[model samples]
Target chain A: MMSDNSDIDKYYDVVVVGAGPAGIGVGILLQKLGINHIILEKTSIGESFRKWPIETRFISPSFTGNFFKMPDLNAITPDTSPAFTLLTEHPTGEDYVEYLENLAKYYDLPIKTEVCVDTVQKKADSFVLTTNKGEYKSTYVIWAAGEYQYPKTNAFEGTHLCTHYSEVDSFSDLEGDEHIVIGAYESGFDAMVSLIRARKVVTLLDDGDYLNLVKSDSSYSLAPFTRDRIEYVADLFDYYTETKVTSVEFVNDTYLVKTANGQTFTSPQKPINCTGFASSLTLVKESFEFKNDYPLLNDFDESTKTSNLFLVGPQVKHKNALFCFIYKYRQRFAIVAEKIAKRMKVPSQAIEKAIQGYKDNNFYLTDLSCCDDECTC
Target chain B: MMSDNSDIDKYYDVVVVGAGPAGIGVGILLQKLGINHIILEKTSIGESFRKWPIETRFISPSFTGNFFKMPDLNAITPDTSPAFTLLTEHPTGEDYVEYLENLAKYYDLPIKTEVCVDTVQKKADSFVLTTNKGEYKSTYVIWAAGEYQYPKTNAFEGTHLCTHYSEVDSFSDLEGDEHIVIGAYESGFDAMVSLIRARKVVTLLDDGDYLNLVKSDSSYSLAPFTRDRIEYVADLFDYYTETKVTSVEFVNDTYLVKTANGQTFTSPQKPINCTGFASSLTLVKESFEFKNDYPLLNDFDESTKTSNLFLVGPQVKHKNALFCFIYKYRQRFAIVAEKIAKRMKVPSQAIEKAIQGYKDNNFYLTDLSCCDDECTC
Candidate 1:
């Protein structure tokens, strides 16, 4: 790979290979501890947030989405009511991205954008990472690039007729009147909703169970604010359910999806594969013995097969279901950051307090209702 | 007294009077628990907040200033930082009032405004509250009129020539070119700053024992903001040494003050009094035995001298060192509210948790750090 000479061969206490939420979160915690580290992003800071569709927003409540030991929303503005200023709403993708940018700027985390890490290998008492920009040696390495970095498509015939969810961030590049979204999960449903909002017919293809945005009691089963957001979107789009699209074909300037229900729906919109991405460790997959496409990890989040390598973020979900959302990611990231900080002997209360605060949110907001306005509980 | 036929004297499970933070807070808790209660306010909801100076803003931090059970700032508006939207670096009083109004509306608190209670006398089974609109008989009564209702001035010779701090909301109100602000406390400092900003030869007069806003560090002190506000008038005024204004005389086209230092400072501007207000409980004081000229309360926030009657807000601090600041009011209000709610058999959590949250100001914005572009925090 071609190399850039910027800060070549610099050694760091910890090196994180992503500038997304997980990486930036770790960087913020580490920065607060005065730890010497660097965040290398192949694209830009909050690249994933930037890639989300215009109508896309955080699926979680804003209260739990803040960075570790960072400023909460109330500190930024005084006129906002605590409920209105803190926890009762969801923000759009563009706004969420702007918020991330503001957070990154506030902490002044040393993030190096456009520095793509090629491989991370273990060395004695440390880890060495080779990137397009330079080689970095660190006592600890966190892989937060996440699954979205690599798009995984099935080995079906005419698979090239579809585009992954990450690639369809902007619909302006595509010329289509209708669409077939392949998946019944959040990504696929989100895409179908987006397409429908654009005034196009969308055939959602999935064999799995369908999760309704609205729960039985009209509340969201996810976060409280998620229901509000889903309702807000429902107000803009109408949706019909349970039609599983089995196959799609591109012919006669149209995309045809044959559902399991013996119905063939033809549309001019291109089929988009919002099946989600797999772990982006293709370059190092051959060198490690993987379990279900994920490297085995010990209790400290250190890879069982390797001493210096570690994993965080959604990639950890490849081994377990945690670390997939903001609330969960908050816990998992803090756990790993604390483990690494302890190993490096960094002195700061940021990581421990963050984890404690995260755990506190689950307890206070969900369990206690005595002070809750609606429950008087 | 003539009563409307609609005035059906009915007994309620609980009756909370005053719809400011204290009243609404109790209402929110009661409503959530399926408890039946009626909150009554003599004026609009949060009348005290509404009556604050138009240029006044919350002195407390946004994060810690919210009612218990309300959401944090981030949960309300994800995209907009709370510090920017709710808590300005220095908020005008109007902002807090608007915020309270929004909170009351959002919670749908059942508050009957414009129903001034003439007297609250305890009956055998319930408390009979005689009001201008009707008679309310309830199991419990909460008195939360707060402290800033009546101005307290020393009866010094010629003291009648000065105006109280509450009346001087802005610097534009004064017509003279010079002034003497009597008091070294927040209000005194506030008045002196405003006068100085208005281009007047302003002198701050007080005993100087308990007037200064508490400061531990000059760098992080609220003094700089206070000082900056006053510097706008620095060209015309000078801060006087610790001097007690023994008397004031309104001479022809000027006001003269006799100080402890035997020095008389004459100014063309009318002397402004920054002496703050005392509790508004004169009418009810006769019913209860006085301790230090104030009503004494037991552990349940119940008057030791009277059963079923509770004292909340600044009245508890009457003739005491507390109740002089917003922080103290917030704490005392929560404690009394919880005690009254529990006394009315309205289920509530331990008072410690409610009081604990009140003491921490991070919940509000002005006392918080915003995750913004230039934040060093």
Candidate 2:
């Protein structure tokens, strides 16, 4: 059910921001717990996913292993699989948006589209969410606003002069025969591959030796899907590892890229910046304490400084564990819901029954001790 | 340890046949339970995986989700991942062999190579396994000899006039510009894709409309990985759906393929047969009851006709469950080991402690009701 500004309810037990995988994931749990909550989407469901570059796809392959309790890697919930719904392994942005829309409809999630929450202020008893639609009062706030829509555009001196990887509609449609791409991460490689398939020559400037770096954690290393794609086009592109771009300068219809190691490369077109994304926490930074740019939260994922404010999604971090992927962040949904429900004094049996499936399928992870181990094989 | 013919053990508590994924998976669990067992192999460890055609790769993608309890799809054990060890999503035959070899070495599994078990006869309270090297006696036997090495060459009339898909060293090395691929499942599509990549023309004959058949279970339909690969070369092949090949005949130095639809196709070289494989159960058909070509087993996957005899790996089946993939069959490893361990009177505390990790990671699936549900989203 979608609500407009005129029909907006002033109070809700909990107000969830964003309607991407994270918000929808936790919202479903709250609904199952019989909590009075509403998910507020700034535009529509999966807007960030809908905005991905036309040629870009999920690096993690999706398989319908839900029956075996492994579920699809990109599925936001235990029972639903993106691969089974979309019938594709690497879903494109549009395809994923369709999946998100289907989940939102099938679960009958209460989401108010076009309701952008501008500021969240906590009063003595509750949190007040000031949105474009109307003011909403809630006992708790869950910050699930994802980070992809907000790209880190000011990473370098003249980064603004180059096209942000997120801004490009499609790499193949770019007007260039030869291109220079800065920040050789997943996004950078995706752009390179798309361009190469378009028969364009590319010079990729990698900030680090990520292509050769292998980590047990998928959050820190290249996905095997990306590595497989690179094998076919490895000979078509020029990759420079350990090369950090210092700045970009434009002079007389030509763009110059300078690196820290004292190398200059010239291109006739704007370089694509694939550095990274800034957390949406910037929107509500004051609500929680911070350490090293990440919000500090309690074991329940609630804001330490705020009484009832909770956090979920990719921005979640604990020590060295980075819960940036759907598979990682989805585990914390039940934890947050259980804590909030207990505080609300919901029936213990009901809470247990609601979370039983999550626990059975390894979705409710309370122990972080095993997260640091490397694969011995 | 690789045992030679001269040092063959004459008796054991449990004797596992065939050192493939199923053999290795069950062996590790038995070792953890402190059971006296030895895995016997006719040739070498991972011999079936090593014999896969050079162009064939695992259709299922591998990812290291061990921390989240969604271990790699191709991993036989919860603690190991093929993707993490080999750094590839879709491991080739040789790459998978390396992973299996690593597991065999890491677990120190007791395996004797070059010992062919030609026959098995049930005696009082024991079973005698007649092998090429010598005679062996055991209280129990686990059949893990996989199906890839046993091609179903007699599926259709005059099949000997065609080359089995497994016999090809490399699809690219075939000596023909035009080829007829006589099966349109995974192997058929795989052959067509490889031939198309090699710049050869292919005519694919599918027994059913498998290309359009979408089943909730992967065992009945094409995988998403194969679907994605087909997108690139969908227009490059001649696909005939609902066409069942009746026979392959040689006429005037040319191969003629006759189909059920009264259509005949001709090629200079022999047609490639990808009709699939016969179960290794054929090796011990008399020892077990058969229903629909699958062995009948009790709740513990033990033979219904023979006492203390168990089954593991792809050959194990329930009402509608097909344990054909590593991820599916690996779940039963603990089940089989636990039954044997309990019969052996291993302490209850030790049994529980040894199988706890498997139970925690979903390596033990005793319920089948949830397996039939389809993805709603």
Candidate 3:
């Protein structure tokens, strides 16, 4: 480890790294209590959501997406639509990005959008953060940098033929003669559908059978107009049409995927990879001592390694269950935000109010403006 | 009111009415335990669903629709798609009906469809259900007959100008005319959209300004495809778009509508209405004393007005919240079915297994065949 030039002169009430769900969530709680805090992000806010495929909508409804301490959407506006209506209409990735942006603007959260923290070393009573911009010294530090930042590629024979899930954002980008998407996760299935829609000959490889873990009230298959053009060769041939791609090799400038059944499928459409993302915690590894490579958090919110340092979002899932997707992110964010605010000695009412508004079970949809025929705006 | 028919002798394990969500849910549960029961429906199974307009789909997703005491969907078949996938694919009224049918067949529940009960009279120890088919006796009656059966037409002058939601199943039946949909409830909005899509001038009426609910995850406005065809003129523009029909008096050659707003609008198309629906429980009022003209039940499973009689489906919503809808019915049915099965002393490991599965939060999607690729049976 390099010698640390840690700054102990300035101390913040709290320092949160990564302006994604967890960081912003804590920032929201602190702002609600009128507490001074700083949020450092390596990129723009909700960069992961921004990178999501255009057609990718939230798997769960908006009822689970509210931030704590805000007014219940229904209480705010009970006329236009209800929680159920809004939830049924799946919000796309762009919609979420817009929602997060609006939320950040609404709270006027204290955030440093482009600051990348390089190290986080704990002093006697505080954490010292060394960033590309400068040093951020705080009494409490929350390492909320999410887990999807790192792209994990296995040492396969043709590893270069695949791309990360983050790279493929739209169907139009999937243009080639034939393509093979690796991984059997939701991302892989999503990519398969997208590639098929783009009219690309596609082969999906998986070590395990892909499962579609969706829930509904009834069995209705609602296909969008965009999806109407795509056709699955095996419609309703069980949940997922099972197939196996064993290996990928180049044949006549085209990638040929060999299946375990001795079937060779050729695809020229630049083989896009849909494998899931991994945690990018290497940057602060030297500074922060992790328990079994984890932030040492207890339950969902408490960070054991550092007193003030907390972890939320997909990063926390690294230590426990992989529950960092959009549906689970907001709910978990609210929990961590409340815990962090309480630990910082913020007023209980403010945090409580935020939690009340943001907690699960209750959902609302509110229109910002009261529109009358006389006044269009 | 006629004299009480307490002298009748009718005994059954349970008599469930209205073959909608609640009725079918309970029926499936009873079937799992080999309980001898009869599910009574005045119309077809899921009759209200069948009556729904072609464009209507469930607001809730499918994952929440499973009845208790059933195998987790994953345990049954991994090929089964989650409720959301099916619902999002082609959301239509018939799609849900088909799912219900599949579930009913899978369980082979004892259900007598199209047996409308005219009255239910409590006897000394059981209940007698006088239906169009025949008089049946039961120890318990669950009222699952849902709301939307009785049309609650507003007592407005020239009421003939409006139509109930149930009758307006298709826009093709609507003739040429500038139409005004009366309420802003779900049905009212649905009608307005349908009329507007049919290229008719449409106006929505609300006592208060319509509340702006939360936006859908996909878009901020109404469902994208549905919103595109319809034009929503808010009440503020009432002066500009008020082609009101004061009196729907018809002449020999054509029908004329006199507008109260000093504008007479006449179209070759008859004005359509979408006020709302009342519960179909009115038929049993003479037979049983009701509180608030609604049966006071132990939370929604109208399994007994007396004994051996159950009212399931939309009618239950009349007495309570409209929970007989797909998402909540299965849960309610599980309770009633378990009680009845226990009363009948049916030997059932399936019910016990299902309860455990539910307690574990293991959803139906997880109930799949263990066989991956080789297990064909």
Over B180-256, each residue of candidate 3 has an lDDT whose tens digit, in order, gives 55555456566776665566676555433233433422112233233322334333222223233345555665545
lDDT at position B79, candidate 1: 15
Error in Å for residue B377 of model 3: 50
Per-residue lDDT of model 3, residues A1-377, tens digit only? 01233322356877878776566655776676676677777888878767888867554333311111111121111111223233333456665555556556767776676677777888888778887777888877767787766776652446566566777767656555456676656566666666666666666666554343222211111222213222343351112235555566777877775666676666665555555565667765654357665555565455554566566665553323333443334445556666667776777887777666444222211111211111000
Query: What DockQ does every candidate get?
Result: 0.04, 0.71, 0.08
Q: What TM-score would each prediction reach against the true structure? A: 0.52, 0.96, 0.66
Top model by lDDT, which number?
A: 2
lDDT of each: 0.56, 0.89, 0.52
| C-alpha positional error of residue B201 in candidate 3 after TM-score superposition, expressed in Å | 9.7
Q: Docking quality tier of candidate 3?
A: incorrect
Better of 2 and 3 by TM-score: 2
* Cα lDDT of model 2 by residue, B1-377, tens digit: 86555446567899999899999999998998889888999899999878888988999999888776678899887788899999899999999999989999999999899888899888999988989878888999988888888888877898889889988889999998999999988999999999999999999999889988877678878899999888889999999999999989999999999989999999999899999988888888888999998999998999999888899988888988888888898999999999999999999999999899888788999996667767777
* RMSD score of candidate 2 (Å): 1.9
Q: In model 1 chain B, which range of ten residues has the least summed lDDT?
A: B74-83
Residue A125 lDDT (model 1): 82
Residue B120 of model 1: what lDDT?
Answer: 80
Please rank every candidate by lDDT, starting with the best: 2, 1, 3
